[model samples]
Target: MTAAHRKIIHIDMDAFYASVEQLDFPELRNKPLAVGGSEIRGVISAASYEARKFGVRSAMSGKLAIKKCPELIFVKPRFDRYKEVSQQIRAIFLEYTDLVEPLSLDEAFLDVTINKKNLKSATNIAEEIRRKIFETTGLTASAGISVNKFLAKIASDYNKPNGQKTIRPEEIIPFLDALEIKRFFGVGKKTCEKMYHLGIFTGSDLRMKSIDFLEEHFGNSGLHFYQLARGISNSPVVPNRLPKSIGAERTFTENFTSIIPLQDKLKDVCEEVSIRLQKRNLSGKTLTLKIKYSDFTLQTKSTTLPYYISSYDLLLDTALDLLANSDLKTSVRLIGIQISNLNINQKKAEYVQLKFRF
Candidate 1:
């Protein structure tokens, strides 16, 4: 017999950036717009629903999107403002249950089987959260509720823009059997092509493939697909789990052989990393600097800081120092800064103050 069902709800805001823009400026309420850089070489971060109807999409090049829809209005992202909204929504989720795991600035998973309200059904809790987000933020959120996180995530997208759906335990079998193979979590474009060639187009088709054959073709990924097709996933909804690492990276469209441009890029990455670490209430003992060559070979150099390092100027200087000592043979394609061995501790000990570099 199967174990008792667990309640999981995945909440995702609809076109978060675009919606926020709409909320602030009522003039853009029904107009099509996108959020991203408006420069010659930039991509769309989010597109309003009206823009999406014209084939405008997030991550599409700004030039291409404009070609698709001539009236596409582009706006720059205000990350500080977005971060504020994220915190507000998170606070809303916490009010219902602490088992809330944020997937991004606008998406989260909530386990509400036995919530603060002592709710007995995931569907009821999903409705309440969705309603509250709209009430407080004036933004629409779609919600999916199911017995597991995987199904719940997919269901949230089933109906979007102020929608909510529930997949009860008894509905799991039909839900999996009817789900498209491409809709399976983590199945990318390449995996879909492989599955299609194997004559697996649906959950039923995937269910028929032997686990061994699937694994032989796709390696460990095959096992995950097999289980998902059969409505089996053991992944938990981890809540408020602090990050283990913080890193920043940048990909340059043009390869850089000059030292000036490389340093500029490194400085940019270090600043981003420092800001991220501070926002998360974290500090790291180790710093790693990474580089990718034009030919795609990767190299990294690291330093164990005498103490936790996070200030922007200090990190940039350290990364440059590390780069100076490394062997370089190719033009750089990408540069990055990473901090690891993360912990919440940041208070300096009295002993450290007495003997610092002394």
Candidate 2:
């Protein structure tokens, strides 16, 4: 089938963390609420719609958020509860089709072209999913429907906070041309600035640039830009994509010069990785130590063990051994440890495949 014949839907929960807090607390509903750390160094993980009206936003400092909205009530994040809710929502998606690709705990892409219920309209499926999510979880989800993932993701944001938008195949070209360049996916601050200087401020301006001009300026990504400007993206909706490796890293506020300090930091990083491995019930045979020098130079050392190891002590020791053998030429700005060649059992692998298959 052609891309235009496919049916895709992107669903995003509105103010997920903050909304959960409000739902549980009752009194916080319709009030300015934020879920995050309340310490001086704490950051806002999510802000309720009421708080957003006052210029409060996620990733802003807690202090700044409070200053912006004095009535903002801060609540600690409940990741466990969030995970439970995520699973509940995932189960709802599964009831329709196995083409559910979760982007995070609160958002996912669903290809309902050939759903279990044999739904003909993706828009109808999106509406039904939103209704089910609200009925099951007491939270609102905004949805976007389109022929492909990119347009669906963008359309999902068009009407948000308990809303839905659909971009028909006939509407793709006009919709894209009216969009700002910054609204295109992967156009970060730096890239937006570059595009602005290159006279590509909107999708219309972007379409005017020849492939050669874009390639000369943006390199390989120019091809993506060229296609996106013409409202063409064929990326598939992949579900249950597992991690190839598990790792953790930390950047030091103060660069470490001594091996002792570096070893201490490595222990912390390894512990973090161990926690993740345990959470995912995973282990690996290869251990890699990544180092970033004070001068921003990067180095990595890796060694493969005979058996998989998930213990914190073993990973720390292996990482330290690798670090010790490597030449210490400069102070370290960042340190990380990763475990690759993961030991995935046949049962788990089969489970992942079955869960993802349509």
Candidate 3:
């Protein structure tokens, strides 16, 4: 359908990992709980709402999280359980529309313009989906309904924790105008700082800038900002989207200065990546090695091979070579390896534009 008339819904589970842990463990309910971290080392994968009140957040170091909330309880991640719940939620989405794009285990976008139920109201469909999710999995979900994926995704976060919001086409302009520049998708902290320096703090400020002006200052992303400020997004929701890359990494409990231990870690990471590639029946021509120093500085080295390879031995050899040629500026805190430029047969999905009266 036409970009302006498409019915998109973004569903995001509230504190997914932490919520799941609470649901499974009665003692964790209504407590400051964190998933996938420890008091000594590692990063938090998710933090419960209670923990969030204490300034605990996902990606925060476990040590810092513990300091922020001394009573915080940590739990290891259960990926298999999360996967099972995700499947159940996916089934619920498929019941209404096949045009579902899963962003992750806990969030997805559903295009219900031409749904299986032939539903006329996207908002109603979203509510039903949320209700069904709670009934089926005993988990609360929030939803955003809008004309396109970007608006829908943003609306989803407006009323979180088992709430839903709908942004009709008529409200699109004003909704985006008053929105904070930092809330715009793809605008990170660095970009926000740059925009702030330019006196662009909101979408309204962004809309006042010309494409040429934006492009001169922000490069190609300037055009993106200009379009987004005007409530324009044409990106479609693609189902069963193929991943662009596959990789694995690990953070050391203690920074390592020796090459032997770093090499051993790289080998383990390569093995993990190789296994993942094999599981997906995928291989890539490009390999990248990522290193994070003790000072939190990051470096990456990449090499493209003539042939695609997913073998563990090949990956280890290439990664080891990359590591050997790299400078060890400081003790290493984290290391990662990724394979991109994957070999996959891709088919373009065709879309027909049709304007809808909302």
Candidate 4:
């Protein structure tokens, strides 16, 4: 079947972490709350809608978030609880279709073209799923239904906080044409700025550029933009997707000038990565060390070993070696370690067969 005939739905939970906190704590309801941070330091992992109204957002420093909303309450993250609730939600998706691709604990994509219930209207299936999620978990979710994942993902955010939107195939062109360039998936702040400098501010502006011109300016990603501008995304939703990497990082409250403190931090990060790799029963040959300087400049060094390793001793040795040989131009504010090129069983490629309509 053609790509345009596929039924895709993107479901995203509203302020997942914060919402879960509020649901469990009666007093937190309707109050500005933040999850996973402290007033003195650290970054917020999630912010409640009430906190968002005060300009508090995820990844914002705790000090800045408190400054924006002094009354904001912070709670520690409970990953185990979140995982339990996520499992409940996933069961609901499986009830309708097995072609569910979980993006995270709070969001997923479902290809319901040939669902278990044999539902024809993707929009109705989305609404039903949302209702089931709320009924089962007492959490609100929003959904976007469209012909493909890209359009559905964008539509999911249109009506947030327990609402859903459906972008019909016929509306894809005009909807994308008027959409802001910044709203397009994969277009980051830097890319948006570059596009602005090139006088491309909207989908229509992006569509007006030729493939050759886009490639000349944006390289490989240029072709991606060109295709998205024409509503041409063919990527399918694959279930049980394997992770490409496992990593961990730490940001220091104060930048460190001495190698001693940096080494301690690197040891802690390496241990965390090792634990994660062991938890997943995975290992990789390629190891990368990331350093962010006080000036916000970033540097990365990577080395690929002949054999896979997931031990803390090996990871720390490789990380320390990379750091020792690197040029330290400035104080380091953050450091990270990652292992990629994983050793995992590869599965045969599978595609969802869409039922074509007249």
What TM-scores do the predictions have?
Answer: 0.83, 0.80, 0.94, 0.91
The candidate maximizing TM-score is 3
What Cα-based lDDT does every candidate model obtain?
0.83, 0.87, 0.92, 0.91
| Candidate with more favorable, higher lDDT: 1 or 3 | 3
Per residue, candidate 2 scores C-alpha lDDT tens digits across 268-343 of: 9999999999899888889999998866689999999866788777787789899999898898878899999997
Structural RMSD, model 4:
8.4
Among all windows of 10 consecutive residues in model 4, the one with the lowest summed lDDT is 348-357
Better of 2 and 3 by TM-score: 3
Q: What is the C-alpha lDDT profile of model 3 across 1-358, one tens digit per residue? A: 5898899999999999999999999989999999987998888999999999999999998999999999999999999999999999999999998899999999999999999998899999999999999999999999999999999999999999899999998998899889999999888999999999999999899999999999999998888888999889999999999999999999998999988999999988999999999999888889999999987789999999877778888888889999999999999999999999888763432222332323
**Model 3 error, position 166 (Å):** 0.4
Once superposed on the true structure, which residue ranges of model 1 sit more than 4 Å away at CA?
1-4, 249-257, 278-314, 321-335, 340-358
**RMSD in order of candidates:** 4.3, 6.9, 8.3, 8.4
lDDT of 2 at 45: 85
User: What is the Å distance of residue 209 in model 4 from its true position?
Assistant: 1.8
Query: Candidate 1: worst 10 consecutive residues by lDDT?
Result: 349-358
In model 4, which runs have C-alpha deviations exceeding 4 angstroms? Answer: 252-255, 293-296, 327-333, 345-358
Clash counts per candidate, in order, are 0, 0, 1, 0
TM-score of structure candidate 1: 0.83
lDDT (Cα, tens digit) per residue for candidate 4, span 214-247: 9999999989999999888999999989899999
